[model samples]
Target: MQYTAMLDFRTCFDARKDIASLLKQEQSSGVDTGADTGVPRQVRVLGQERDGAVLYTWSDVSPYRQDDVVVSHIGLYEPISKVNTVLFVHEKLVNLVNCTVNQERTLLGFTTQEKAATSSSGSPSWHSEGRHHAQVYRSYLAEVQPANRVFYLNIERDNYLMVQFLHGKGQGYGDTSSKESHMLFLIHKELIGLYHMKLSRVGYSGVEMCGQPRTEVLAKRFQWAQWDHQRQRLYYLSQKKKNSNSKMTFTCMQFYEKHPPEVMMEVQVRIYLPPEVSKAPSTYEHLPLSKKVTDQKLLCEVMTLPGGSLCICYQHPIMNPDDHHGQEEDIGEYDVVDIEYSVFMLHRGTALHCCMPGFARLEAVNIKLHFFPFSE
Candidate 1:
């Protein structure tokens, strides 16, 4: 029994030694995570092994591969002076990771100088493209006059960030002397017979919006259009209530908000409308434009519910074998005709859900049901 115990102990020791050797080899091979020594405080050029579940490395940084641009690597320069190093080789900006901190620490993006960040936008000032990020799709855009030298950022439901910059400055066509108008939206909710307007300066960073919720003055700044039915509440990245700049809302648009606000950033102004309990299509008299509504009674029925789902399902019989006897036996088709139904959740307060498909509903016999809990 004593001999057997000794043998067992020896075997365990050998196994542990083998495991350690394997781990050490993995570290050297860059296959095992234990191999990564992390980056040093001082920058250096070493390749990353893999990405996601496996070790993957990019051939280079900066999605732009052109040679006409300049690149810069900005790092935390004492957090105050902020070192902004400009690279003359490439046009697009790129950051290189040189060193790692420790065993548990990871190398992320580089920091930049404060002065470079805050240097001159409207009147030579740096700004941060903060907050208000999203991805919008299939919409139209009209430039606000006297471009505020500000950009708009679009935010989406999936945490996807986008940017839109205001490229010009000056008032629209006829008003050359007026202050450049900012294209922003006023978000609001209605209660009973009353409307509460909340204003925010939304969209991109460079495009600065007036900061206030006053309706009478700012209402004339924007052109209203029929909203696409495939959406829900318009969101904005706000700094402070009654004092903030909002990221613009609409689809398929992104802007740059890469830095911090060099100047005071705030949102202001709003346009409010009272609530209407009925979402069913009303009539041509209630419509904003002909393209905005086909049938008011039908549209009135498609709006979202207070915490309930939008069941836009048409009540027609489906194309299944049970419902479509006329087609008779395996015709080699999907046998599916989807009806339409969209849903939007009420975020606490009572807000009307808008669903305007621009077409008549197929009813219960045939309907295209949105396969999601919320429209994208």
Candidate 2:
């Protein structure tokens, strides 16, 4: 029995030695199958590929390749007085990466001094520094529709992060099919959760072409009306007409505490057009070159209750030669109409109605609030 045990132990030792030799060969081969070892932290250029892919070998393994057309870049820079050594690069700006010692590489290895990140336009300063560092584990790019063009980012107003995209079909000019959708998302400094305007998965009507001419009266119909965070109320503007001959109703839909959570108010507005403007056609291809609407009526339902009010306003005039040059006059004169709406309590539900009346009418409605929700 003792002789048999000795023979088994010898066989196990021989097998262990064979495995270690194979592992050592793998480490030397440098295929990078994700293994870690303690070694000096010097930057090493591991190897290059014929296809132009380069590998940066260090404590971590990183392979980088970039295409043209990406001009701006953002990444982490390790500064030593006047020089910057880029320890990490963000994938979003990886297009600026190059195998040769390029300008970005030069900038990375040389930063004059640490200063507050300055902003010009269309870009912001991306800098992060502290003893404890935050690292991104994984990132991915979203496949957006081709119709989604470019977007503007403004960090100053309401700390707003707005992403505007063209939704649905018919994105062509005079294409009444597709409409612009504003997706609003709010980020709070304290909370990691996202605060956004709630949308109803269902309930809203789709945009429809009314008459034969298909003149777009409410082509881009939905606009932000108001948002009272404290009250948990949100409002949006829309225009609806019963028929081709009927008058148009300016409508407002109020959302409760949660976005698209619940309907708290419904407001409809109708503007009283002046006699001269009222005589205009239901769907006129051209303006009559004069007059404007000046009065408004509100049929509002707050929560579940109903109430309304009438508003009368004055007519004003303006002269702008660039707008239109009628054959009647060298320079045409038109009426400038301004109407304002104010909400009052007493009803459980809310409603707002607005109308514009005139042959050559120009309307401007101003609603002043503590914080403006929409940006051009």
Candidate 3:
């Protein structure tokens, strides 16, 4: 059987195995920055970050001389929406998992393969632009703080990841339904050394096999509209009809506001054959045509939205590498962008596991899902 050339699948055995393997491997070859060392087994511990040390350089950061190395707190989001988590259990099969992480509207890790697939008249190919890298998304989560933004960050698996739990027990079971504890991934870098990261959660709605009672968030109420005046903001009202009193505060941002003006120039000439019009205007804003462009054939082609009445305008992302248009997948996809994110809900499960004193049980929580993939 072919195995993943980059990593050893038999990873994470025990701390003794991890330290012993590290020392053994270090003795033969010194661990240098950017050096590709063999992955060690049992590389994780109950309360430590491992992935941080693996993705970036572990350089000992110098004292602040610039005093301006700012860490911008950005809300990274999916290029499109995601519905399910792809749990990774195999190593060699990484490439087999065909998916579009289109979480950020722009393509990353896509190669020429997916690009060609997206270039057709109806659907242009784009997945082939970025290199195919292993991507993993985990879903089961108990609220650690009762609130978490549903988004993900790309990180290496070999590095130390700090895994926290929902309850203090870290048993990863139940307790106060309210999120209290957390599991973190501590990464290792050659320069920065270690950084802590929290795992992003995905939606798990239909899990009959799990046998536990899972709360279902019936997406019945989703109201959004825009005044489109100078305010440039869109108002949205969403509520859960299945469980009355459950309110959903959803937001969206329209990133394609920078669409190049779609202009159609026409010349108006009343006379059948006017004496050669000899004017070369500096600006061609006004063409000399008046036979109004009314023919449906003359109008640019367009597709109707799902309602069968509304028209949809699909714009491509701006080519600038720095443009946020590339980052408009979730909230940014709306006609307006909001800086504040909030969620307040009151749910009652017809049948939910009531926790026993020291023993907790498996739990499933509902996270709103709206990510839809589109070529950037």
Candidate 4:
């Protein structure tokens, strides 16, 4: 009803019988019919079919550009032979149905009447601020190449449940023209158990198979840590300990954190062990190489700044290759010492800066200060 009033279009249909009856009544009064003929021609209208459902054309308006338009529709039906006789369905109901059918997102749980009720009452309701607008939940996903940097993500209040999955090049499932496929999953609060079980079982596709829900009101504070030291640095630089004038070449890694403006970000950094120390033990040695590689990790927070840079420090011993922090007893005869630095991040749908190799002199080095949210 509000949409019809706002658009100011007469797209509703009046019953043929009612129009005929009205015309006959006007004719009996000797009123001229020539002027009345053009009244119906100005309005773009549609009528109910023989099956009793009214068909109408609908358009999905683009928020960014006015010219970018999409056309779709919705239909409504009423049961015949009703005593109450509220009569035919109105255009406003048809518009509401069209919005739902066309996937034009609105408030997830709250209804139009509920929102109106809260507005009328002037209460601090759940649908306050930008929650009532579909634009608030807008999400964008893109594709990126694998590299070595940490990603700082800031999840919006209710948009966390909108899980998005993207397929890389050659992983197309639906559209051929697209090099990647994207899918969104909305998990409800009540269905979280099922969601968790599915996620633990088969990853994101499990959420897709569980239910194709449009929106879910699932909001809960979650704190967790993940280790992703799977990627290894390909090549590392080593300088002779005795050479004082040796050139130091460092590999630089750039990272980006894409998030909505003004949101705080938290990131976990995972640095893989340097290549030299990670090498297998010599064949003549009695001890074999340890299968597990210990990774050094740190937690960092980012503030409202849109973009920032970070650097990890690499420490190599000059006097003693096996000496680390004066802990000489832990070094074995066959052990080789090395210093390495690496980084990783997820942008669009690709992993970046996962494995970069660099070497530096031994010292108690601090990471770049600006990388953290707060600096001392």
Candidate 5:
């Protein structure tokens, strides 16, 4: 609920560069500086409690931008190596800047763009004339086409997942036309896997299938989605129309390189209101003539907690104002009402549905919910 500031973006960037330079100097001279160097190191503490525990704080600063380069994403890389590194992604490059204390190393960078334009004959341009010798050979996984722009990037060890948007020729960022498609790429070292999907007025549809037709099991646009890097699983909430009523379902899915996404578990979302809020009052004379009690639910947001828990905020109608009421009918119906926001935690199966780390099984658990009241 509360946050404290620690390091800013500019400070972190400069510290990483300084550490990297120190490591390079020691490597060339074959010297172990250690504690003898008398240099102060940067310390980062995270996720500590207040009661007899070290309270580490982190602050989020705006992305660093210089000249034509704009940082699109910034995150701490998974601790696969001995050195702690901060990851930075821009339109054309990915940089892993070391941020370790006394121990430091050179920065790692990768170009995420393709060189040389396509010829007018629709053939490979690199093979023609004098361009063949000048062409820079790069892996398929590292090359992102000029037409596509990365919208999301997630890195876990050697695996990289990038979601790109194929935009029009003159379209800017976040601008999408009807013909645009979203491309999902998963790269493990040199190997590349791709999943392409297009959004239509109805829902989402796959642009290509592996072997057989999969039209029946395709899902619509996700209402909410969260990815768990540790488990390599993705959890999402979607709505399904059953006859006249619509139902929401929470699903756990996993992605594979050679195959399509695998569905792990699915459960219908159910919310049970408290008895006090669900029941209507017996007296109606004190209420406005143009208003009545109604039971309607509206979803606000869905987010994942730290310990693999999910939280949902929604609003339930306690009193509904009649839209058909005329201005001359009653002035009390237009009176301003005070809104109340309340927070409560409910158990799964009884109120919400959640999946556990055990994978296949669905457990009944408690989830926190925030409710907001509305008059209209």
Candidate 6:
């Protein structure tokens, strides 16, 4: 569970040397090593890691500028097979990389550059447009494998969302094998798109759509979201404004294959702020005034606790506007500032319920709060 050593370029170079020596020995013994057939000569190593005893090295085909590193050609070095497979050779730049929870597949997000076309008059014309793409590749060591395009996204080029992969049993998607299924989730602001791709032993069920892609647009912007793969649930918190008051609403959504996703539970609680404190200003000329505070500002965060409970922590800043009206001369002398914080837990069972009054406190200085998930 803990890392004993860091894997770097040196590790890859050392592994490559060992593999080269092994290959030379096999060749000398008249052994047929057909795995390394079409590896290129020039490649710069980017990253390398080991899965079990097999070493996987990622490299770029062409030399790149140190100021602007744009990865166009990607390759993978397999030590066991003695093969350096080219994963992708693109005309554009690859910007994002994400691996599945099982670390068997890697998702690369990149942009396609617009190619110049020849005009009717024999002049070159630029398209002035580009596209965004996401491609999945097999990261584990294999005999000879090529990258696959699971699905294509039509999102705008400028709006790049982080791609997340979830692998589990496809309950109602006609997948009966014990092999886990693969699905991808992309979040763009308040919109969440879920795409299902069943990965077979050989490869994935090609680029054809397995099922209709599911999308959910929330009413309000959410702070963060957490997915529970075991229970097949998604939880998020959004804030709703009612007149001059605001309340945080927590929602849980359940996913299914045939039926539409449904909300399993929702809870809303009004945020309460402590009373503002007022103090007489001192006549000290050297004192400095406190920074101006907003009328009623609320900061909220959510974390998942152990035993399937949700913990929400929020802070409210209390400031007195009337005390600053005539005290501009002695603003630095008044020392009355407070911030109130509250923490509560929501438990789920046959029926969702909120635990009894949780902890609340007021402090003079603003305290940075960090909530540890699944910690005792």
Largest lDDT belongs to which candidate?
Answer: 6
Score residue 72 of candidate 1 by CA lDDT. 31
Query: What would you estimate as the lDDT of candidate 5?
Result: 0.31
- Over 192-249, each residue of candidate 5 has an lDDT whose tens digit, in order, gives 2333433222223211112221122234434334344334355555556422134557
- State the lDDT of candidate 3 residue by residue for 1-376, as single tens digits: 8876653457533334334344335535653211132332222221111111110111111122233221211111111231111111121111111111111111111100111222345453222123232232122221112223222333332111111211122222222222112221212110111111222223432111112222322122232111111122222223323332333233322211223112121111111111121111011111111111111111111222233221211111112223344443421322332111111111211211122122111110111111121221
Query: Ranking by lDDT, best first?
Result: 6, 5, 2, 4, 1, 3
Q: Distance from true position, residue 245, model 6, in Å?
A: 2.7
Error of 6 at 136 (Å): 23
Which residue runs of candidate 4 sit more than 4 Å off their true CA positions?
1-117, 127-163, 174-376
lDDT of all predictions: 0.23, 0.25, 0.21, 0.24, 0.31, 0.40
Clashes of each: 106, 24, 81, 15, 1, 0
RMSD per candidate (Å) reads 25.1, 27.8, 27.5, 26.7, 20.7, 14.4
Overlapping backbone residue pairs in candidate 6 total 0
Task: State the TM-score for model 1.
Answer: 0.18
lDDT of 3: 0.21
Q: Return the clash pairs for model 5, or none.
A: 348-365
Best by TM-score: 6
1-376 in candidate 6: lDDT tens per residue?
8877533334544544644444345546655422222232233333332222222223233332434333445444555656544444443344323322222433333222222344576655432133222322112111112344433455432222333334334433334332333343433223455543433444553222234444444334453355554455666655554322445577877765455568887887555322321111111111011101112133445555666666666665544456456544554534445445566666632222232222222333335444456454
**Which should have the higher lDDT, number 2 or number 6?**
6
Error of 4 at 47 (Å): 44
Model 3: lDDT of residue 285: 12
